[model samples]
Target: MSHSSSDDEDTDISESEISEYEDKKYGELRNGVQNVKTSNENGTFICPYCPRKRKQDYLYKELLQHASGVGQSSSKKRKARDKANHLALVKYLEKDLMDVDVPAKDSKPTDESDPSVNSHEQFVWPWIGIVVNIPTRRTVDGRCFGESGSRLRDEYRSRGFNPVRVNGLWNHRGHSGTALVEFSKDWQGLQNALEFERAYELDHHGKKDWFANSEQKSGLYGWVARADDYKMNNIYGEHLQTMGDVQTISELIEEEARRQDKLVSNLTNIIEVKNQHLKEIEMRCHETTHKMDLVMMEKDKLVEAYNAATKKIQSTAMDMLKKISIDHEKLKLELESQKNELELRKIELENREAHNESERNRLEQEIRENAMKNTSLHMATLEHKKADENVMKLAEDQRRQKEQLHAKILHLQKQLDMKQELELEIQRLKGSLNVLKYMENDDDGADVLKKVDSLQKDLRDKEESLEDLGELNQTLITKERLSNDELQEARQALINGVKKLSSLGNIRLKRMGELDTRPFFEAIKKRHKQKEVEDRVLEMCSLWEEHLTNPDWHPFKVIMAEGKEKEIIDDDDEKLKKLKKEWGEGPYKAVVQALLEINEYNPSGRYVTTIVWNYKEGRRATLKEGVQLLLNQWKKMKKVSS
Candidate 1:
């Protein structure tokens, strides 16, 4: 429930409660009490709430409101307002200067017309009236004026004149008063007063007559004049000049007054014009300052924008550089990969080139051998031809011999020529055989021997390679056993990991079985009833919770408060237990538990056992339906009782 505004009037209440209590405390005190105090005996002095001395703050506020009302006629009301302000200022200054004292000194000839002159021209306006509070009565020796007004009047009298009116201390009790005095008709009187008072001391009886003292104990104490121009009329025609020159003096005085009035008017106009110029200057200064501020703000914004753009550009450049670096790295890796591939290709090419070179060398040797064999065969053919030619020559020689035998007488002569031809033919056949032997030995035979030696070395190298392969196979067989053992251990570890996971799952299942219960759903049903179903569900839940938490309290007690035990017919204990068990194995056990905890219990009908026994065992037949049915009956009873 919210508090009323009246509460705020109680000062004991905090600020936050003020809003609630605003309306009740309209014009009342903070204590919620109305004021009954009346005004003063004189209506002009009436100050309500005066008995409460702590009303200074409120009084100031009321004074401000009063001043606002008198604004249009401010010149007329100004005197009253000034009185009030002066009274306040006097009181404040009195308090501030409680221990302070003014010392006395003689006056000095200091020009009051000079604005910047540091003479008696500067009086603390707020504290001026305090000097009037001084005690100066009982006609102190050598005094020409009475009490408080004496100090002011005598100072002016020294200047050969009197003030229109002056503030004074009338009695020894420091009572404030004012007095009017007349000045001489001649200007000399006024001039003398103006000059001499510039050097007169405050205390008429006891003091040096100079105004040059710096400390409070040795300084002139008279305040400067405060009378307005119109008041000066009161000081005329009473002293100094005679009645015979009155007319002429009046004329001259009038003319001089007119001239002073004209000068004042011109000064007023000039001041007005200057004031207007000052206002314009101030306005221009403000506008220039505002424009400069705007320009500076714009410059700052531009700088920020430039910085943001530069940052974005830098970020983009960094991103591009990153991309380029990645691409460069990728290209470098690809180049390295290609280079390695080329190197492998070159090695493969070199292997192929070496194989080709070996094949070419073998082919070249075969071609050389074939050439040598051909040369030998050609030489043999030449030798054979030579032998055939010899054989022919021999046959021819035989024929010649036979012919010679037939012509025995001619043979002796031809024998020498035949021998020479046969010898030439034999020499040619021998040369041919020697050339064939030289060709076989130098070409075919040497190449066959070199090839045989190379064949033998290659056969030895092949046998060594086969032996090395056999040892490598043995080493591979040993490594295979170690690898198989490692594989078997890894498989065993994987199986163990699987078993642990299965065990953890089984443990989790068992723990869930212990935690889940039936009360969970009752809470869920209660919330659903509040939101969308019916409020009866919540009522039922409340009743159920009472029965569940307080095992000793039964629903029958709440429903049958008149001790009507016979009306209690419902019981669902076994069903409740079955529901509880079902909740344990369900995946939503936490949610169900939360629900049941929220809505603990609600009775509906009779025990299932009672109904079954009545129907199956042929027992007494009176039985309620279930928890819900019992709830309906109890509700009906409640309505009837109501």
Candidate 2:
């Protein structure tokens, strides 16, 4: 239902009139609703007076329609519920009316009655009064109110409405507060107030101790109202006046002229002061410029002097560097020559050692062979002596046995001859007995038998004696052969002993003829001593090189402290002292001193290669070159000392 402009105006007037009439009629409704206990259920409409507890889940507009009997039955039961619901609705409406400050009913509706009045005049200035319930009771400073007002003002301003004024009031407890904000003439204040009220209700619902019971609200609550002259005066002070009280144009013009006269007079005075100040600044600037010119001239002179001094220093440094480089090269060459000689000496030593080792092995082999030959000779001599003793014993036994055999042979020969004669006599007696056999028979036969028996016995004795003689002869011959063999063995053993002795004598002669190595050993000892000296010299040269090349090397100065020289343990220190004494403290002395200091301070030489040479600055010598230079310096020192 869109209305024409006139109709809209009429409707607005009617709505305003009704609202005013209702506010006046139910001025005590807010108090009535304060005693009514409403349900806290959000978005739910219920009739407190109805016996049947019926709740309608509806929006506020729909709930209003339902309570007003729209689309509802007209039955007696329905009518009774409707009547009870209407009574509850009336209280809520009254509470809503009390939230806003409506115009009095007796006030004239000028814009609605007189159409000749401007439409803008019909619009109301939207003034909102908000109640912010603070959570604490602490003392509120003025800043708190100021911050709150500023926020509210900013909010209105952001919405394209210029807030005329924003004011705040704090309660004694500082636990609650109120803010009154007035915006430029518009009905938007009403909507803003309504939204604030809803937010306040939602934020504080079910929160304990948020409000003075549920009758009072918490958080932010706002209501719209017109700002009258008294309210405006209270908010903006007495400096603000209504449009009707504005001065006439003639009076305004006269006042503006007077203000302009004062402003022009003040501007003229400011101009005069500014001109005077400018003149003083100009004079100071002139003096500062003049001083700056003098300073520049002095700076030029100083720069020229500095450049000349730098050039002189650079030339001197270059010449010193060149001299050092030359010395370094010479030293390097000398060191190289010495190194080559040392290498040659080392090779010679190795060769001599090899020769000595071979000679020692040969001597040891000869000694071993001689010892073996001597051992064999000793064994042969023992064998020879044993053989000779055996031979002598055999000869003595042979002689004794020969004598015994001769005696036994003679005795046997005598017994054999006697037996032969007895046999002859028995034969003769047997012949006579045979002739007289007949005459003397028995006696004679017995005598003959006896004689024959004695002869047989004697023949057996002779045979036994002959057998003994033959056996003795065979034994004597065997003994003589054994003695002869033993004698030959002794002779052969003696011959072998003689040969061993001859060979041993030759070995001894050869040992005596071996070359003497005493002079070779002495030469080796001398070479070792020379090597030690070379090593020391090499070390000194290296130290001197480091001193020349390394910037971090700080030379030790031989200071006469307490009227005596400090004792240093460094070998370089001794060498440096000698050099300085001989040279009488020149560049050589400085170099020596630096070398000594480096050796004394950093024995490990860990920072030897850390120095970086800058080519742009000058021709800096390399480590090798510097080392050569140091060697030359050392050689000169040695020569001078010698």
Candidate 3:
């Protein structure tokens, strides 16, 4: 019967709890006491169950009601939410663990007594375990011992774990060399360390054991509560250890609270002392305020005095301004008069400037013309000097040739006289030889034979000498013929040079005449008929022909003529056809024939005579116009070709 009642009571309580949960709104429970005011400047009452405050104006009963209602509702909702989240996390962890494929050997159970294996499957408090190998001698110094612990702590942290404590154990013997490290309670950090270990194993596959047998070992090992430990220990061992640590932490917190209370008491004493100092300062400030009032009174009196002085000075300045205004008016009138005079002077200066500019332009044109004339004269002078030098050189050559010829003639005459004397001696010897032959019949025949032998030998020697002389004379004659040819050539060259000089001189004189007659021809153009105009044009054409035909004409003129011919032939073929149309084919053909004949004599003469005749009246202007006409005709032909 008692068991039945207990079961009924449990049923009743469960029904009541279910009813309460159903009746309460989830949004209201989560938000908590929406209508209750929590902020006020007045003294406040702090809620014990949560971090909520209310003004003192709130009734004690209302405050209690809020605490019992909304506070309980929030707590219950939070517990339910936390339970659901925990279940979800557990399911996720199970899925991850099942998916992971750990090696059979690595997953095998380790020794139960090994402290390196973490027995706890879930962490209630933040605590990680780590073991590190540290040489005993290195831990002899306190700093080295700290460094070893720090190194172990850093190794865990480097793998994304937060170490809370690092403890190093050292001994005199080298055998006891170990460090312990604790990390913050973070499941992600634990998972990362496990993942790192797994990756390290895979990366070093087929090699020596990465964790235990490496020559350059990291000397580190980490264990976390979330890690799957192969060894089994007492299931509640970590809970008991955590409880004990919590008890020790509570004691430490109480001690710290007592120390904080002592610090608060000390601060209160300091505050009280500072309050007394503040009171003294306030008293001094009041005294200073009283003195400031007196100073303000004095400042007001001085300001009134200053205002009076300012008023007097302002009056004086007003008088001075009036005088200055009058002076300004007078000065403005004077400036106006001066401006008027300046404008007149400027106009006069402008007129003078215009005259000066025109004069300068005229002077510059005259200077340019003079410079051209001077250049032509200088070239002509150079040609004259060259001609004189050539003439002197030719005369020297002629004189030398005449001297050589005279010497040769004298040598030949001497040779002829010697030959005559030898011939006469030969005749006399022959006569004596005949006389000796007659004597040979008488008894002196041997003597006569000896004499005749000597005479014959002498004749042979003489005849050999004569043969040598004859060869020499033949060579001399050949040399004389060569000299005569060379001399004739020199004389011809001299004559040609003389003719060239005379022609250049004639061209210069003719050019001067053209310059002199240019204005006269321009003046006569008004009254001249086409025939007269044609005659004048012919005269000009003849002058140009003579100039172009002269071999010694100025090099510049020759170049100009060659350029004109090339420009016409290459650029103005159509202009030649146009002339055929205007002047008739017969006259055009005649003109062309004349031009070709002139070109044969001197290449520069082509088109020279025509250009001179066409441009004689207008001189430079007509020449430019004719050139433009030719260029236009060439352009039209090019367009047609395209």
TM-score, cand. 1 vs. native: 0.19
Candidate 2, 1-642: lDDT as tens digits: 111123432222232254343333233334453222335556344433333445534445544455455213456444332343354355354234222233233432223233322323211223343334423343345323224667767876675545555655544333235555554222343345334444445565321334355565544544333224324533222212211122222343354468568878999998789667656655665665566567657756865786577568656755765675566557556655655655565455445533576886865665566556555555554564565456556645754665576456556645554444344434444433333333233457777566656655665665565565557567779999999788556544433333343222111111111122332333334546766755654554465555455555444455577999864434355655674554344525445444444454344552332221223343333434334444565687799999
In the range 284-325, model 1's lDDT, one tens digit per residue, is 656655665676577568657865775685567557656755
lDDT of 3 by residue, 54-166 (tens): 34344433444444344235454344422322232222222222212222323333233445334333432333343434444444444333246676567656766556556
Task: Please list the C-alpha lDDT of all candidates, in the order they appear.
Answer: 0.40, 0.45, 0.46
lDDT of 3: 0.46
Clashes of 2: 5
Residue pairs clashing, model 3: none
* Model 1, runs deviating above 4 Å: 1-186, 189-247, 346-642
Error of 2 at 625 (Å): 42
